[model samples]
Target: MTTPAPEFNKKLGFINAFTAATLMGFVGFFARHIDAQGDFIAFSRMMCGAILFFGILAYKGRIKELLAYKLSIPMILSGFFMGNCLSAYITATQHTSIANAVFFIYIGPIISTLLAVIFLKEKMKPATWFALVAVFIGMMMISGLMSVGPNGLSFGMEFSQETFFGDMMGLYSGVGYGLFLFLGRYRTEVPGDVRAFWNFVFALAGITILFIFTKPTISQMTSTDWMWWIGIGIVCGFGALGTCTIATRHLKAAEFACVSYWECVVAALFVGLLFYGEPLSSGQMIGGALIIIGGMSEVVISMLGKSLKKTDKQADAMGAL
Candidate 1:
């Protein structure tokens, strides 16, 4: 079988990453509808996602392959990182202000980019760097760090022992997520579905152990809550996680990170429409646009680079003949 062209693979990666990010935006909406603790929600999501994904593997006759595949240290670490990301983010929100939580968690992109550069030796063009800066600014705007105050453009910079612990948790979550992406860049042998299945399994195991100590067991959820959990797990878990994992195979961690910013845009739209019943503010609209533009710029730049390389290869072949 012929290997896919680099440009084609990158395009597929962009599609998968964007779709995954878009679907993940609905997670907050589902969480809002469900009446359960954060840990419970995390557990339920992983459990449901695991069950559904395993079912998919079974139906596709890939379960045997998945079971037989030797688990590498990186794969196991990736699963642990994924599981910790979810649980830590939930814990962070419970303790800190939403703004602080989001700010810290979104730092994952920067971390991932840096790790890719240092460890993976992925070179970034000047344009890609500029796009990263633009995206970061856009994220800050969406997080309301751009809001002016009586103190004149105070960026909501407040630190206290009260929220410090939660802020650290959020930061840890970002690191975990970044590591997950970084590790995924090396696991080219693992199928996306198989990776996603084990990710949720590890996540479920971690969350379940935590749940043993925490309140709001699965038994405590109402029928309505269960419905919401199921929806979140199947949709966000299976759809989002699965696609995002697959995307890493075709995209650099930095590129995937840029695309993941789409989640904030999607979440804002959904939350405004369904929960608040109001349009997004001008600031949010601008922020979202900036993020989209930055992400697209990175993708386009990468595609063009690949296209040029392909053209050069073809020209060389013809000259040799």
Candidate 2:
């Protein structure tokens, strides 16, 4: 009995998707500059986000909604993987270049798209194949596995052990992100805000418990560090809340995957301008371009399809009336 969402809703969804993608880029900057250690940053951000989101639920007199929704083990398991992904991706930046970390992490969409085809029985469009190819070629360029820099494209067997490890962590991040999306898309029936709240709550709980094992140097931080932690917690905390909720609502999982590619672009731009004050290299520029193209090509095509469907629906409705 539900009518198709209006074109206006779809357009608003796109705006939300774009804004979320853009804001998530700041995560790298936070990880780079926050006074607290990376693990603390991850822990604090999730904790802060959960508190804020739950507070809103309480304000709405929906605190009981959380307990009312029956939580499944798979859903909880999804949160565990998500926490690991967040920590690994942040830590990868410490071990490798932001370019490598961000690019590798953005591969989530490819994983999600493949899963959709296999598990959801979704068919791949022509654009999807092209996007896959573009994503692979672009990722290669960014990783220096197949350099397309000014030195000209070269295939090198060289791989730094440190960078290789970082890349693996980033790849794991993509897998984690993909799994999170799959859960949100196919498994959870909870409202977007509610799901987001629980995801962070679970993530926070996991981190707190995990912290007991790590013996972190939290005691050494200064007041200046505390301010950075608070700032990062507030910024990324709310950013995660808003973006994750918005992106999941209007877009398909694959579409969300595509939009997430912006996170890398945002990271590269902010990090380069703020930290290095250096221009992006030719390879990064090209790889980024291809990633953007691969990411959005399907989305654009999907929008056109939606518009046509809406027009057809309008015609049928007019005839019925």
Candidate 3:
């Protein structure tokens, strides 16, 4: 069988990453309908995701390969970080305002860029840095930090003890997420499905331990709750995460980070339409536009840079002949 073209794989990877981010945007909606403690929801999500992911592998006749794949220390660490990131973000949302939690969590992209530069020795273009700044400002606008009010866009800084703790957790969650993405990009030897399966395994284990310790009230869930849980686990877990894992193979960690910002835009649209049933503010529209433009521009510029380099090399070879 002929191998697929490299450019085709890269394009597919970009689509996969964007699609996964869009699916992840629905997570908050599902969580809102679950009526469970944060830890319980997290545990269930991971456990269910793992089961479904394994089931998929079984159906594909790859279960044995997944199970037999050697689990390296880095893989285990990545899974642990992934679990911490998800759980911390959930808990942070419970304690702090959703805006605060989301804004802090979005710091993951910046962290990912820094880590990629330091460890992977990836060069950051000035254009990419400008794009990142634009994206950050856009996210702040979407978070309503720049909303005009009676005080006229106050940049007040006040944090209660609880909020302070939650903010710290959010920052930690960003760190964990950044590390997870960096590791995934650095180590591409593992198959995406196998890596995703192991990630769920370790995440499930971590969350299960937390559940035992915290022991949040286990109330009876309605059929609706179960439906949401299944969606989060099977659909978001297997589908979103599996595709994201595949994406890491074709995109740099920094590029993937920029692409993932679409989750915020998607989430904003979803929350406005499904929950609020109201029109978005002009600020939100502007912010979302900035994010999309910045991210897409960065990716396009990077790809063009690569294409130019390839052309230059071909021209040089012809000139030498």
Candidate 4:
């Protein structure tokens, strides 16, 4: 198959990333009615999502590759870590503020960049470094560091014990997500669709096991609970598809990294509008703006860099002629 032109690929990638963001916006709506058993909700959502995704693959005759099941250990590890991250995050929210939870969760790119620098031996661009710094500042603000000004300082700064726990969980989730991203990059032998399918499958299986050990029963769940589960499946599952479509088709590893950060922005707006029934706080609004700006900065800079190199090459060709 012929590869698409670079410009076309970039456009396609942006579109895919945007679609993922839009789809993920609905997750907050579903999350609001989710009762006490957040982990159970997560398990149900992952299982249903896996079933829905695998069903599509099977219908499309992609089941052959799946049946061959050449499972990559890294991919499976990524899924396991991701599943654990989900459970941790949900558990954390039970103890912490959502603001703290989400602020720390958005730290994925920073963690991923750190990991890439270490394990992957990847060199980040100047813009990427700047973006990371921006994100850190944004996170500090989101975590309510700014609330400690004027009359001395509030020792807790706006973070409750629950918020701290939530932040911790979010931090681990970011690490797992980073690992997932890293593995997805290197596991080139696995087809994108197949890898995504298995990631969900493994996550579902792991969470299911966790649920079993916890002795979770759906008998206690209301119809609203079921509705949220279905919504989660639709939002996160199809959101993953949208992400894969763009990342696989058009984005380089770095570009994909940048695009994925939009998930945080989308999630914040969604949760605010749906649950809080209030506009995002000034801090959240500002922080989200910076995050989005910083996230896209890398992609924009990379595109410009690529364009400049192409122009230089063409000039050299003309000089030779």
Question: Cα miss at 296, model 3 (Å)?
Answer: 1.0
CA lDDT of every candidate: 0.81, 0.69, 0.77, 0.64
Sorted on TM-score, highest at the top, how do the candidates line up? Answer: 1, 3, 2, 4
Angstrom error at residue 287, model 4: 1.2
> Largest TM-score belongs to which candidate?
1
Worst 10 residues of 2 by lDDT: 1-10
Tens digits of per-residue lDDT for model 1 on 34-151?
A: 8788877777667777888899999998889787667887787777787778788988988998778888888887888899899889988789888888787777777676653466
Candidate 2 yields a Cα-based lDDT of 0.69
lDDT by residue (213-277, candidate 3, tens digit) is: 66877567888887787777765677777777778767776777778888878888886666868
Residue-pair clashes per candidate, as listed? 0, 0, 0, 3
lDDT by residue for model 4 over 30-144, one digit each (tens)? Answer: 7777664667767655676667767878899888888665676887876676566667667666667665555555565556566667886777777777876765655555445
lDDT at residue 309 of model 3 (Cα atoms): 83
Tell me how many residue pairs clash in candidate 4. Answer: 3
lDDT of 2 by residue, 1-321 (tens): 543442224565566677777767677666556555567788877877788888889899998888877788756866666676777788777777765665556666667777777887767677767776775666555444566646778764334876887778777887877776666554435665677787887777767776776556778777877777776777776565455655655666666666666655666666655676857667777867886898678678778988999899999999999
Residue-level error in angstroms, candidate 4, position 137: 2.6
TM-score for every candidate vs. truth? 0.92, 0.84, 0.88, 0.80
Off by over 4 Å in 1: 1-8, 148-154
Q: How well does candidate 1 score on lDDT at residue 182?
A: 84
- What is residue 166's positional error in candidate 3, in angstroms? 2.0
